[model samples]
Target: MAHLSLSWANVAIVLSLCLGSISYGYDFSIISTTVGQPTWYAYMGLTTDPTQASLYSYSNSIIGTIFGLFSAGAIFGGLFVGWFSDAHGRKKSLLSAAVINIVGGALQAGSVHVGMFIVARFITGFAAAMLVALVPVYIAEVAPPAIRGLLVGQHGAFFLVGYTVAAWVAVGSFYSANASFNWRFPLSLQALWPLLLCFFVYWLPESPRWLVSKGRPDEAWKILAKLHYDPKDPEQLFAREEFFQITSQCAADKASYGDVSLLHLFTKPHLRKRTLVATLVMWASPANGAIVIYSNIVVLVAGLGFDSADSLLLSAGWITLACVGNFANAFYLDKLGRVRSMVIGYVGCIVFVIIEAAIVAEYGGTTNKAALSAGVAMLFGFITFYGGFVDTTIYVYCSEIFPTHVRAKGMGWSIAVFFLGNLPFLESSTTGYATIGWKYYLLFIILPALNVGLLIYFCPETKGLSLEEINGIFEDKVAVRLTNLTEEERRDLDSRILDGVVGKDPQAQAPERNNVEKSAEVTLDE
Candidate 1:
């Protein structure tokens, strides 16, 4: 991996953006917990209980609409973010997501009818997906290569936190004395992260890469210095090298792709490959049983004969386990590398989901405590492992691959695919469990099984490279092996690149692809 100092400037940015991620979680997932509550039943006029104290059986379509519409809106939000973030700028796009989130959150809290609630779900989904999709792009831009996964994956970790909050809020709403306050308060909680984002919007530094692409190298340089600063080195060697690399590569990118278009993703062969990688990764994002567990586990546990209250609480614990897994992902993600971790996550999901389906098939609707206990235990274990391997894998991997020119758009399109992917799971869950029972999970087994093959073929390892350097991988060009170089070697290489005209200018044409990869291969193995 490339060497860059992990400094306080970078840490602060990670912490701040975590709030946006948590907010994204609230809307992305809270629907699961929200719809489970009795107050929600009464509030939506599904139950006649005036005090909003009883739950009722809403048809599959209604429940599906609640979950499906949010994702439907999320698909639009993720697609819009590409143009919105690029045309308006990162900071403004973030603010736009926050403000819109607030409107959706507020309306959800005040919704008087199911129609109003459904509309709010769509509106809320739009902003939440926007926030989650863009946070990785911003974080990846500012992060040092050494700890890039740790920072970029924060949204996934804290997103689990938001989901955990939803679980707890659902538990609390179940017991609240006031009916309206119970569901209303929990629904309104979706605004917390966005509200904090609105308050702190001024504090966000613009993405340095976004700045450079928009023709402001000076600002990008300062942001890089502040983020990757090293007090011990007065020369700011690593930081300076990064600036040169970013500006040089971005210039090359501009020269190559004039006026980047969304169509370029499919039309240009190089970008088409990159697009295929991102789409495949994201298309599989909602593929496995992970989303099924997130959205419908409480219902599953309830089927195991745990009453509504205990079911919600256990679901909360399950989300907490997922959060722990996300933390674990940050610690070792770069070490395992994205492709391996992703494969492991998918394969692991296959094993545990198979066990869970069998358990649900045999023990569901029964008071067989021991079998139910085993079933629940397997489900929880599956989530923890799933979280560790997959939570941030798709977003971090996809965001890191694209050049600055279409990064936002690529991510937007990628995230949109993710939400669109959710439609299948949500739509199926609505009717599958009621009709096929455990067989629905059997359908999930196939996608991840297929994805393992797709991932190994389409994705390349990008563990230790700057965003600028990542360009070479897709183009079959190896620009630089900055990670394997020692400090003095890097300084010397930096000097060589600076005295440009004597050789192939690093700014104009990158070094030949095969030579650098062959050399770096030996160093990487060691």
Candidate 2:
């Protein structure tokens, strides 16, 4: 329980990182509400059929392109994260992404034509995707090992907070008489997050792990010391030994890597397995086709005989439930571990999505409130499971599994695959929902069933391991951790362990000599 406690430093780092997540959530959810608004359609100059009750008549293809192109831009952004974060470092990368988002948000708020709006969305999507990749890596690197998974999972919780805010803003703006200003205000608000990030992020400490990777151990040790223990406390000894281990591991890893390249991920056996696992988890993210369903939720609701405003409002509730689910996930992920919790969510999504599709196919065209209410409930249930497990755990697994030398690249490629997987769903969602209807959801149901199987078989459990310790899994050694030690005992053991491992003092290794020799032999055999 003591290991799980959050210090002020931990809270500060986590809250600061959440700015990027909030920014992404706001932009992602606002569109669902905005696109359904009369003011938004009127401002965009979409044509309407005179006899139709709804004023907007944009084709499904047009809507799909508008949404899908954002996914396209995100793919480009994710591709850039590996090089950018590796070359410029994490802080600079995040600062650069903030500037890009500000420019895009400004353009989107002021867009006067469809083309301008489309371009702005692409730019914003690109920025958002980079932030998505950057924030988790930063958090994963800085977090204390005991709570690393919990902190990494916060990305989704905070993102859902932003989603909830956007939904309410869109609903509030529905009554505005000024069509242009109604949609404009929500888009403009996207600037607030990045602005906050840019101004405050500099005050935070750079990742000590990154400092170690760059051969600056003095700075790395100082930062790690400040983050973990009081100057006079016995716990400082553990922090010092931890620094020694990190530097040793980084030097070894650097030698092993030689010249790092993207191809090396596929060519190297252990890294390749790690890469494959990361990629599959990301591919599983959209296995339920949740993103496609969410993007078109407002429109889909309207098509079910609900009014536009009501549809937007109902969509808001779905996001609120998602926020709750995400928070619940952050609480339980460490306890349940990554794979089991995610499987629970996927299983729930599989059941609810099937039920929802059947309801929509049979009763979507009519005005049966009971059926429609049940359908909405099922969609909410799907998101509850999705936001709780898949949204957060996928990023956690991707971030924790990669070595520090290639972490950004590993996560970057995973996110690229994430956006890539979404492309087909995004491109087809609008048209599929209109033409094939709920049968489109059959693809979603089938894919997640398969994904659940893959997750059970392939996904590794990574709840409590340090970033460096995870390497043991690929090398076929058991994970070693000090989490079970009382703080006082850990402080005492750290001194002796450091003497044996770093000082080569055989006397200090007496207590665990046999265990250490066995582990070494196994590691060497690989």
Candidate 3:
């Protein structure tokens, strides 16, 4: 057997997977501009007073309700995406999301009424949910084990880039004299990204693991040859040991396509813990009130006394800062243990939220420009900490928590719960702000504290470990001791596990199965 290096073909496959993240990011941020247009309010016949003749008035409650509904749709979409991706494959699921994006974007851009617009937003939100749920899974599967953290971290970086682009686009559209139709252009333009993804994804290969699971060893070998080894090498000779190990593991766990049922997620031992860890990590991801703030920073800024134009500019700036922060996170994720990075981020967010709360309490919507600027600064601080750490870690953590058999489903469940936590805040933003005033920052502060506590107790370190090693961590007895392994041992383990090559020695197989069962029992007990 000949040794194969992780080659350019592998890098190309990873890049192609990363594009799905870009699509997810682009779709998520495009709405910020469109929702703020004057025509949107005018079409709804909005007024300051709810008692007036307007359909929805410029009431915070109405806006919050709209945002909340979108979140709800996303929760449903996330839930649905898991089954879809499992049944249809990641590429096909992504293509489905792209189609939804096109339809939703078109409807939203050309909407003639508030009802139509809200419904369109829901449709778009559903598509965004699918993207969020599946993109990380795709990236994780395709990435080289050595760079999985970095590549998975790139999802957040790309998401912030999408957000930054939307911010600038919003600013430009608002500044244009023909702002009415220009806002529509930003929303409409999102359609192009998904269309591009749909075209390009067809050129990419199916997940090699997925092929192995389905017993198509020849196809899986061909893919591995193209992706990691030289195709001209003797068939099954290069990486034969590694490939045999991987295939053996897959054969041990083999099940038909029909056996990939959601019930298995709960009933199967290996899968149950995976589902729990994925859920917790995802629940922690957006639970810090970051998504609420991201979606409604315009309003939050107005509460700080900035005029609409300045608020938009400030929002744009914050998002740009966040994009930079996300890039920094991508650079550091592998060096910083996932658990540590996430903890540090949550701690920082807690401090910033407290400061922001104080600023809001001191100013109390007082129209004092200095006070408002201070509030904006604090908010920007919050964004910086969030994007740099929490945002990036969530996707990486989710990607690492599950084994190949249930990775997509685990991710989908996590995203669905994330959206569920997000929905209430998105809907009640106006009520939360109006009733609590500047004290609304309390909500953000509280969640991160809870998040930090959860991490301390539940989350585990995943730095410098192979997928199989990480999988072993959920078991009570495996000890998760990667620090003891030599570099060669680590590489060999990763290659063997990923290529489905595990020895049939009872000593090895017994411990692994015992670990899987123990992990499942622990998760159920939790």
Candidate 3 residue 513 C-alpha distance from true site, Å = 19
lDDT of 3 by residue, 1-526 (tens): 1343466876666566555566666666665544555655665665434456344435555676667767777888888888888777877898898899789888877887777877987888798888877777877765555577787787788878778888888888887777456677777777877787788778888876666555455666566556656556543333443344445444434321124566787887767776766677777766687887888787678667767788788888988999999989878988888888888888888898898888888886686788778888888888888888878888888876776666777787788888888877777766677677767778778877887888878777877665545656776223233335676876776555445433322224434443543454455556
Candidate 1 lDDT tens digits, 1-526: 3355888888888888888899988776777777677777765666422253333235456778888888899899988999899988899999999999999999998888888988998999899878988999999988888778888988788888888888887888879899787778888888887999887778878998888777666677678778877878665666767766676566566556656788898999999999999999988878876776788878777777787788888998998899889988878887888889999888888888899889988878778899998888988878876899988777789988988879999999898888888897897785678678888888778888998898998799998777877877787344345667777986678667556511223223223322333344455445
Best by lDDT: 1
lDDT of 1 at 127: 92
lDDT of 2 by residue, 1-526 (tens): 1244356786788899899999988877777776777776666766423355243235445567778777888889887978889887888989988899898889889998878988988998899889889999999987777687789889878988888998889888877887776889988998999999998789878887787676566667667666776544554554655565566566566656644677788999889999999988999887678787677778777777788788988898888888888888987888889889889989999999989999999998888989988998888889988988777888888988988888998988888898889888888886677668889889988899998899899878877777887887777232234545677877666656555553433223323433443444456556
Off by over 4 Å in 1: 47-58, 476-481, 486-489, 496-526
In model 3, the worst 10-residue window by lDDT is: 501-510
Model 3 per-residue lDDT at 278:
69
Root mean square deviation (Cα) for candidate 3: 6.0
Q: How far is candidate 1 from the true structure (C-alpha RMSD, Å)?
A: 6.6
lDDT (Cα, 0-100) at 159 in candidate 3: 74
Model 1: worst 10 consecutive residues (lDDT sum): 501-510
**TM-score of each predicted structure versus truth:** 0.91, 0.90, 0.86
Where does candidate 3 stray beyond 4 Å? 1-6, 47-58, 230-242, 255-260, 476-526
CA-lDDT, candidates in order: 0.80, 0.79, 0.71
